[model samples]
Target: MQSTPSYLWSTEDLLGQGATASVYKARNKKSGELVAVKVFNNASYLRPQEVQMREFEMLRKLNHKNIVKLFAVEETGSSKQKVLVMEYCSSGSLLNVLEEPANAFGLAESEFLIVLQCVVAGMNHLRENGVVHRDIKPGNIMRLVGEDGRSIYKLTDFGAARELEDDEKFVSVYGTEEYLHPDVYERAVLRKPQQKAFGVTVDLWSIGVTFYHAATGSLPFVPFGGPRRNKEIMYKITTEKPPGAIAGIQRQENGSIEWSYELPITCRLSAGLKDQLIPILANILEVDQEKCWGFDQFFAGTNDILHRIVVDVFSLQQASSHRIYIHSYNTTTMFLDAVFKQTNIVPHHQEYFFEGHLYELDPNLQARHFCRTTESSPLTLLSTSEQPEDVVGVQYRDPALDFPKLVPRVDVVADCSAAKSAVGAAHQTLRVGQALRRGRELLARGLHWVIGNLRTECSRILEQRRGAHSVLACLQLTEGRTHVLCEAVPAGGRAPAGLDVLRTRLRRVDEELSQCSRSIFDFQGALDGILAELAKDGQQVHEDKSIQQIECCLEKMQVIYKQFKRARTCLRLGYNEEQIHKLDKLNLGSLARRVLSIFQNGCVQQYQEALALHSSRMRKVCEIKKHLKRLSNRISSCSVEMMECQDCLQGALDRLLQTENWDLAAAPPAPSPVPLSQARQEMVLGMQELLEQMRSVTCDLQLNNSIIERLGGAAPTPSV
Candidate 1:
């Protein structure tokens, strides 16, 4: 047993021990959160400090839900042992889940798919970041039970992880022999001190082996013999046929047993699942790296048979649209429910008319069955009382040329004008009222939509800032560890002066990064306030209020963007400034150059990447602002037209009141006021055009929201 750090960590129990370090279940004193602390021994041959630092750097750069999170790093004891505090997975490792007695028959197909997807996704993320987890194995993968009780598999144990150079070749042999590909095994068996270089494909092979173990509840090739076991395992991996058939046993009267490959357990997989999985396993286990199935191929193949369907919903009344992904087995009602949840449409008032027929959507009927009887056209939803023309008014028609002549012929011009004015006045008043109501609704919805998008973007920015903070903390730890090592050197042979300079520079960089973190917190607070205000029930929607909200969002986005720019400038100048003043004048040494390069790659490069991401998001915000401005202007124009129409109607009504004895039956037929009708028609068309624009902006906001959510946020909870 080892003593724990009294202030930061309180060790509850020893978890496990490895070759280089011992893991303990600990509680973080400040946050009071449970975490797994891996404390390395100072004298281990594994060079534990170096390995821990490298793992920390890699984990800081990679952010994925399916990857284990590195919380903090600390140097403990007089020996300067490194301890890594990481996310605690209460469900243990995947190996434990597979070998448990309850799962002796192997995981269900769905569970297996979940594990496979998560691992592959995590691996893909690593590859994208130019990293290779050279030691991907079942024991390196942990199972975490989420708050909802669903198991999430995360890739961990990055001690063997490496960043690959453009033309890099890995000669070091790492990982468990059982999970190694044939190519790796061949290299490991070479007599020379060095091995041939390998790439990320080795990880795919390990994943395949892990998948096999999970599917069969056994290793693909059993180890036999003592000292010669490695050779035997290599031979089996290279020359033996892949497992697909299971062995059956028969008993004779004399108690003799006969074994045969039979149906009792064929590769320990059901026929349906095997058909889908065997091909993937074969491709992953390919001996040549080039022939292995890449992430995109596996993703495409899996999605094709995954039974998911994308449903697009268009709201005729509100002129809003939403796209949702659902299972093919979901009923029509379920699909409609999902659409309504997103669009905020009341289910009772929802009468979805599609393809010229009234779809009486039964709650129990599957969508697939309903589509079978309908026309093959893509589904377009409409309110039962709404016409196509009502939702999307004729775009090309000139109102002046298209107005109908509604009055009969009249000899007296005065009589005709009076009758025409009466009818026109009534119709104009009705149209003006409708336009005013719809305009207000559109403004409200658009404001709300933009607010939602801003919330998501703000959340993503906060997540990115958190990652940056983690990296900064790790860099500080690296600085501390280096200082400790320097102090250990003999007093007669003082440590290099450049090391002191590096530590000072690191401290300055960390202080600047702390400022950046605070700025992000402020941005988040502002966004939260905006979201809360927007969410208030029955809040009045007016042009001024909407404009004020949009302006506020724009201002905050610009401020955050500027902050990111300033941080990038600080990172670049901070390193270069120090180098110019100190390192340039000193006698150049290899260690000093290495330390500076590490700082550049570790801190400056990461800041650059973050800056680029922020700039990209800022461009999106600019686009949103442009659309918001247009929406505000459109509402203002609509308001002016509505007021004018009301005034005209009021004047006509007053004139009609003066002619109290006007004849009803004997009134001469009136020639319709074509110009007035045309004006009204044009106004209606303008309102429709504004509605279409609102819909387009809403859709754009939704898309950006989804992108931000996927970038850093957790998967959205399915709507009930």
Candidate 2:
């Protein structure tokens, strides 16, 4: 380095602090630029000579956008201690973002993908350089916003990183306790007698844990009192065969372990994304080294997800919507092609509107333009068998890569009374026409939004309604079987050994079914009430009606503008310093502003009222949708649990039927209870019915998204 990076700012202005080092935000005096100075404490320096120098050497050698840039090594002015000057990340760490209350359920799907992409890229770089990041966690990953205003993540804190080949092993344990591999935890934290060496796969285990935490906003494995308090259980839970991305624990010390094969219901990642992610996690977080995916495979899997574009799209012709995944960069043409493949609708026959603006097929038209993330409203695709003519709509798309060279103090579309020339007046008229057309389309959209919702909700309700009846029928059949078993057991005689388990499972089924029924009924009631309220306040307004109203208001404003122009011409005929100035300022400009305001007020009264009503409905719809979603999740989970119950019940029923009094084994075996056998048959069939019905009742929300490619001249809307 020509000149050493300086720590001119106060050390007290800290950016982050860790166990071994304190990072401060400092300004480099040599170049007058901001940088992060990592000053190690004496404790960090006391490590083995190689260990102390390894981090700096590795960081210096590694060069990637995802890896923190090493500027220069310098010394503190006060103590003359060695320190590091690295790239400054003003956005802080990934941990800070995760800690926000809003992200309690983990990052939104898009942000999670970004983190996944950056971390994978960064790790791939490290692997290429033969480096192992022994301690990988969210806190160690720094976040910085790029010039494009999107987050760029960099791997930092190389204190525990070292060069390691694929087969190389080091018999040392170093990692956060929560993220430590079972073998490492046993040797280092457990202090057990062992001679197992750690390899590159240990980093995979850590990465798995980090990814889990990032995806779920919590660690994968935690016992009653954390990893430290119940070390053996945590180790056992992790090392157990048939692992999943999520970890569960037994309630009691002596109880059998409980494991979940899926992420929590509260996790914000979409089902489609989660389906792709869980497999990668399963490959990476394996307890058995032989089964874990190597770096190459890991890179391939993550890059696959990153490279594929997934978004929801809504088709009006089909009166339905679904998610689409594009393997190429998401451009408007690419989007239309993707839709064509999925829906068999030709691109030429399709008309697309995003956020009420028509999407014109120009070079600038991209995915960002059509970014409706919510299931309730997706990117609108108007699919007709025949192509339409003269599609008049606003198609100006903004960009993120650069700003337009706009003229100062200039407006694109001058309002009435503001046009000073014929060309300007023509442009203003065209603008008014566009605005009226947009308004008309908005009205159409509002109407379609409500009708589409009614169609979707009614369909869902019908499915759930049928499911409820099936469950009730199953419940009735189950009750009948249990009654038969009750009849078989004498009034005070001891029941069969397996009878208790059978009863317990039946009780669980009963409770879950009741919960599902209540949720569905409540959802139905809310939907009915909202629809009725809307129906009462609603009236059909033709698109042309609003356009006519606006057009008439514009005509009145144009008349005023002509009269003002004539008056201005008369005033100019007498052209004087005092008279012209007064006429232009007090009369012309003030009257124009007042008339335009009046004109706006007159035309938008109906529009504003309808907008307010729609906004209110949307908010109510949002809340109800959340409730419905929660209910849907519960029903789906209940269905899975019921299937498990059916399995357990089948085993118990088998044992119950096969039971015999062993004391009388020498004698002929007692006759099998015919009533009990009949009961078993009924219960098994009924349980299957119950599960099938519950599965059928699950909420199915579909969305169709065709986003304008990134800054595709428009930004994608973030989902709530």
Candidate 3:
């Protein structure tokens, strides 16, 4: 038997067989490298010659790290039993790992990262290489566990992939049912009558499903009938919004998952790691492919996210971990210095009383306590500093990673004297007077600390100056730093220098500092405006509450008036003049009883009304969501139809080009108006026509996307 050099593999030991193909562990006798041999079923291969050609062509072009390498093809046997030889991985598949997540998983983040890296690497590589791995699932991803028990993943099985040679065109009905994109699937089957054409983005839809399984060890969108029944499920997953990225955070009281028993490594992990994964996963699982990263972009983003996780959570604490925590009400001006010191990631902040003092930071910095405030929920900020792990009375510094955590929000309020008094008071009334005073005191102290730090640093810089040039340079540098300091301090706090001289000299050093100080004046004006607006709003709420109280009083008065009229009526009737006169002379006690009765009735009615109104609003929101789902289905269908039409046109053009190139090579040196001249002319004309058609089609597709995006109520289309 004769074999070619490319024949690095031959099937020997059978690994397993699926419905479509049988996989075998094999070795190249020549190179002596172990490999996996996948033999396509005769039915799927020989049924149509084009199918085999397409599969072979796709596999040949794809060469990537995460994707399983296709080494060779054997075409020797008379029966023509075709085989695809790929790089063999020791571990079998992701399905088995998921089946026993709690038992076999080494570390959750590590496991997730492997799965994330490999799947994304392969998918992205494929997309970049002009292919879409339509079938993306755990079974297709093979893993190998290392000595450290970490899983390394490799994406396999591109049999279902479609070659999307053009980015603008769409290919229809080309993925596994369970993993099929809703828009593409809808278009393939014509769910919507009017919708046309879908695009290369369908691969991202499948990736969303893949990510869901990777994170929670459960499918976000499961099909009852298995992969084949995923058509309808995909529609729901893609068309309807899944919970927002922070939905889990909202559902929990403390924004922490309640685990029955903590996992070994997870218990030691940072809170940032826990919170960060949710948002990253949420972005990956976005239904809109445009919002999700393309293969290259996804990997780049993955690297950044992974690097942050390692620096902030896994690696030893260093200079990078000394983060500045800000309050939600904090201005951008306040953190201008911090932002200038590092790459600007808006510092997270919250409005909270930490250690009996109220402070505000920008909400972006406050991971644990953003968008949370209620009677039951008091606030605190997570401080990041170089403080020792065993700092006296500190509840939160980590020895392993060396980070600090704020005392929980609930504790902040409970530990306060005012809070304890409020609860103990007979009237159950909250007195903010003491808490306000304490918060003011802290603000003053923090301001003084900022000014002192600025003064000390400035004095040292100026003192070291020896020459004319050095002094000028020192003054300029000091001015910039000082301006940043002043902005960070609260209102009415003095800057490092007096305003008049500082403004004139500072303007010469850096326009930004000068501009920022001016901006402060603008901010102060804005603050005044906000205060005025708040005063108006406060009056409105007060007036409404007062009106409600007055209405209650008037209602009681009505009952009294009615009783008085009845007494008068009885007196006029002359049936019981003595009794009527006695009733008319009613005392405070009797009048109070009647008034209380009316007031209680009104209060009950108000409660019932409020409940009814809440229920009505909830129902309306649900109804709107349902309509949006149906509209989404319609839009997806349209998208698919449009995609299919575009694909057909693109495919036709590709065929024409392929044929034209063949003709150009085969034809003898052509003369004008020769035998093949007309044919060649026709092909060129067809190519030109196809190009124009593709352009128009692409325009239409973009318009449809904009419409869908607008209807979905998302932010306006971001730069692709």
Candidate 4:
């Protein structure tokens, strides 16, 4: 190791020993820069030169702010003493910070947010660059003091880091044993060593597990069994729960206690924070890796969380003076319920009486916000009838308006097998007939409203253009060009007043084009919002087809619109002689060629653009109409199933009610056997199959299916 001269920069003393190297604080002699140097321990049989070269190559390419910087690499004369120069983090590792507080790292919520954001962002950057920090734990994260005096987090140690595409055979096991994901250990323990085909998602799982530990100060899952307990944990990670489990203390209303693996990791967060976190967390920890949120989501989520923090802080001070008013739509039920139960309405919507002066707004306001429906309702019903509107636009109070309510039904069908046939018979005989009648009537009314709205806008634009054109024609006849030219003979020259008339017509066209563009933009925004909602559902055949058709149409429309935009830009610069000659032959007076060209081009472009956009949008509507054909077929099948389930439910309800009313003490403890309806069961099975097929489609296609919206409605039960 002494043959090659060591580029040693000895300044600060040696710090401590790591698992594989000796760390020292040092400053460069020439540059006067502070850095940390890691000298690897002697390798008995392993090739130190090859290992250090690979590690240095990977380290030099990483440029994330949250990742430690590798300054330089040096090898001793013996070719065994390899030293890596790295950025020095003065604050030290997070493991050191956690050791300070016994109560599971008692970090303030704000500090926790900062740490979490930094770590996720750094890891996300690495993943994007095709690298995975296979070993990510508290010990490997280094914290440094920034200019703002805030602790900055950085991920270190690239010795175990592997290129995402590397397929080399596995050798020595890497990473801390306790923190290893099950898959990692499995690959290491294989009889014939094989390179694991892990993706970027694996790094994310480790980050999630790390955050869970950071928040609660413990691992969510504890492996129970012996020597290879870590392996057992890994098994649980893959086979037991594809998604990471959340740990928390939960209490049942009946005083029974049980452990829940599905607890949201953010359950400890306040209501405001939890509300903001749920969706983002769901995206980050999805079962399907494709749907998982990457670095982009982390930044967006961080901004949202920070905004919420500000609002939360402000709300605390005005908690007493600023009151939250809860209003009900109907007082009749509430009054009656209060008389019997000593409370107003359901617990979730029970009105809170505040000290501040409260005012009631008009009733029957249009519902604009999209909110989740209650547990009892499958559809998110809109209450736009403007009655009993509180300070908020809409009232989402339950109709029950009763307190101390009766027992909620735990099951809809008791004897699933027997109930199916009876339900099918009743549905086909009565329910299907009724639903068909109702659906036809609803479709007719919706069609009328849509057609009327489009016709009115089209008529208005046509009238404006007609009137503008007539005015321009009348000017030419009244003020002949020669007479106008004589009048325009300034002290030295003459021009016709007819030029003014042409200018006026041009200006009018410009105004009309502006209004049309704004109208189209508004329409597009509405469409975008609707599509966003549809994206959340993975199933729904009709929506998938409709969304796909609309996207293709939109892309084509955008191309045509771009061409029109370019033509308009050129016209605004001034019309050439060729365009002027064409207009002159049409007998139109010259009135600022540049302005005239713009008006003429815009007139043509606006109509073309609008037509393209409208035609594309109409194509979407047509495609959706086609999907309705499939939906109709599915609905017919659903009707058969719905009846079967209804019969099963009613029978179960009858038996329970009879037992309660008759007080039959000698009755059998077990309820009578109720079987599922075969026809209804088959119908239900069909809906599940359709839903699964929809899931196989791409994200863009799935959005059109409106699965998210359907889920909240009485959509059929999807197959697992």
Highest lDDT model number: 2
Q: Against the correct fold, how does model 1 do in TM-score?
A: 0.40
Q: Which ranges of candidate 4 are over 4 A from the true structure? A: 1-19, 30-33, 44-51, 76-80, 102-106, 165-173, 189-196, 224-234, 242-244, 248-271, 274-309, 313-720
- Return whichever of 1 and 3 wins on TM-score: 1
Best candidate, TM-score:
2
Give the total clashing residue pairs for model 3: 26
**Candidate 2 local lDDT, 12-113, one digit each (tens):** 688888778888888877667888888889888788988888888998999999999998888766676678889999998999887653455578777899
Per-candidate TM-scores read 0.40, 0.49, 0.39, 0.39
- The 0-to-1 C-alpha lDDT of every candidate, in the order given, reads 0.51, 0.61, 0.45, 0.42
Error of 3 at 668 (Å): 99
Q: Candidate 4: lDDT over CA atoms?
A: 0.42
- Worst window of 10 by summed lDDT in candidate 3: 311-320
For residues 1-720, write the lDDT of model 4, one tens digit per residue.
Answer: 122143454424665565677777776656666778877776522655666576788888888899999877876555556678899998778776654322232243456667777787787677667777778887788899889988899998877776673222244556765455445556654333556555555555566556655554545444443225445433444334434334322132222222334423322233334445445544454434555555466557755564331211101000111111112333424322321231112322322111121112223421222122221111111111222212111111211121112122211222111122222222222222222222222222222233333333334433333332343233223224323323333232443333344445434544544454454445445445434433332122122232233233333333333333344444343446335433332221121222223322432233234334333443443343333333333432333332333233223323433533422233322443775456534533433332333233222222322332332212443322
| Candidate 2 wrongly placed segments (more than 4 Å) | 1-5, 9-11, 30-32, 77-80, 250-256, 314-322, 329-720
Q: Determine the backbone clash count of candidate 1.
A: 0
TM-score of model number 3:
0.39
Q: Rank the candidates by lDDT, best first.
A: 2, 1, 3, 4
Q: How accurate is candidate 1 locally (lDDT)?
A: 0.51
Task: For residue 708, give model 3's deviation from the true position in Å.
Answer: 70
- Model 1 Cα lDDT, one tens digit per residue, 460-563: 55554444344445434544543443343333134345546555654555565455456545555654554455445225333223233323333333333333
